[model samples]
Target: MRDEALPTVTAICRALIEQIDSGLLPAAGKLPAERRLSELFDTTRITLREALTQLEAQGLIYREERRGWFVSPPRLLYNPLVRSHFHEMVAGQNRVPATEVISARQVPASPAICAHLELPALSSVYQIRRARRVDGRLVLYVEHYLNPAYFPGILDCDLRQSLTDLYASRYDIRYGRVRFDMVPTALHGEAAAALRVAEGSPALRITRINRDQHGRIIDCDLEFWRHDAIHVSVEVPD
Candidate 1:
């Protein structure tokens, strides 16, 4: 019985793949409801769902909480060394990019944040949280800690704009040297909820520290990205 069912499953999978490839189901397009898809595929719901799961594992589809599956978008290429803003890089790839400022406020730095910024314990730092989207898909959530001494009244500026541009125009500050450390980890807490992904989902956590030309630390950033939404590439010179 199982052997006979294998061919049916394979057929259903192939038909769906063909639809996706033919652009009938475009990237970011939502798949039909499971019941409708089951009927269309002329297969049992269990069998149809199994096929969908396989497609998801293959990086062709993704599921959202309380939302049906959608065709996965092409992964964004990220080059850390480029020094380009997020919007510019996404635009270079012909994709629309957007950023949302969740919140910005002055806060006392924690021990870890202080250490990263080389500030005294409990020093004031401006904390900014942002969510970035590509082609209408939320892909990254970031928390920025700025050394308040270097950026007085920085919170008054528009937080939705690119920080790189703001730093140059307002404070004559440009990034000098950046240190990046990335790790594969599970996202949790506010970051997970903001990205609309399940807690403990696989993600990449990247920490970046930026310094000024005088070697003064300007800010530290923590970014959480969905594992499937980005590809990191860097050219190393020997």
Candidate 2:
């Protein structure tokens, strides 16, 4: 029985691969219902699920809670060294991009935030939480902390727009230098919930500090990205 089932699983996996390669299952396209797929493959539900799991492990497919499986979209190319904003980068790749502002408010800076921003303890900072999507798929959740002293009326502006542009237009604060630190981390709490991924799922955490012309920190950003959704690339000049 085991031998027979193994061959069936292998066949199902190969067939699905062929479908994906042929564009029948286009990137980001949802797979058929499990019952229908099982019938088409002439296999039991358990066997069909096993086959799907194999494809997911290969990065050809992914599942969302209660949303069924979908063909994994091509990973977004990201260059941290580039000064372009998220919207510009994604549009350059011909993928639709959007930013949703989750929350924005002024908060007293915590010790860690204060240290990062080089501000006095208990200084007030604007905390803005946002989620970014590429091709309608949520890819990143970010929290931005800005020292309110630099822009007194910042909270009155639209927070959903490109912050880089906002800084330049509203406050004449252009990006001068940036520092980035990246680490592999598990999605948790607000980050996980905002990205719609399960807690403890693998994610990439990026911490960024943007400075202005005089080297004053403009904002500190914490970005959580789906590990499978982005490909980081950097060019080094010799």
Candidate 3:
């Protein structure tokens, strides 16, 4: 009787994927706890975990560490050529967007930071750290290092709002030329903690260097996106 209930690891993964594809497990919906899942799949907890881990690697599911696994949502389509900011872009795609300012202050730029904005080492810059959400799930963690010379007293404004919009309205600054660098990498330290995932989790890192309307370098951004949460969609002119 006991042996009859057990299923192979592949069988368990197949069962879960079938459920997910059939919409039985809705996107962003948390899967049952390990014990419950083991029973549901009629497999050992270890076997069940292996199946779940495979699903995670496939981007079919995501685990928020202690929060358990959730069905992965549709990836956010991102087009670098578009000028829309985070809030605007998410809204345009019919997804709810939110930003939380984690920390904001003037800090001495490190060598790497200085190099990105072409500033001297130890130059004072505004470092703004933020955790952003889509559909109520934390998906992006970004740090914005802004040259204070361009926008004075910017830290006093609402950091949760789109910096692009803020720059234009307050300092008459707008994007002129932008540079983008991206790579698939592993999450660590602050980025992993911000997204509630384990260190070494798969991630997408995007680095952007922004020059303002006057062609002056104004800021540099480091963005870490959950691997399953976004996909690039570039639109080139004919």
Winner by lDDT? 3
What ranges in model 2 sit over 4 Å off?
1-14, 35-58
Q: Which 10 consecutive positions of candidate 1 have the poorest summed lDDT?
A: 1-10
Writing each residue's lDDT as its tens digit, candidate 2 over 1-238 gives 3667888899999998999999998999999989999999898998888888788767788777678888989999999989899999999999999999999999989898898899996698999999999999888999999998887888788988999999999888988899999999988889988877678767889999989988999899999988888899999879
Q: Against the true structure, candidate 2 has what lDDT?
A: 0.89
TM-score of each: 0.86, 0.86, 0.95
Worst 10 residues of 3 by lDDT: 1-10
**Candidate 3 residues 29-74, lDDT tens each?**
9999999998986778877887888889999999997889899999
Q: What lDDT score is found at residue 158 in candidate 3?
A: 93
- Output the TM-score of candidate 3: 0.95
Model 2, residue 19: what's the lDDT? 91
lDDT values of the candidates?
0.89, 0.89, 0.92
Model 1 agreement with the true structure over 1-238: per-residue lDDT tens digits: 3666677778877888899999999999999999999889787888887787778767788777778889989999998999888899999999999999999999899999989999987688999999999998888999999988889888999998999999999999999899999999888888888888778867889999999888889999999998878899999879
The list of candidate 3 runs beyond 4 A from truth reads 1-7
Q: Model 2, residue 111: displacement in angstroms? A: 3.3
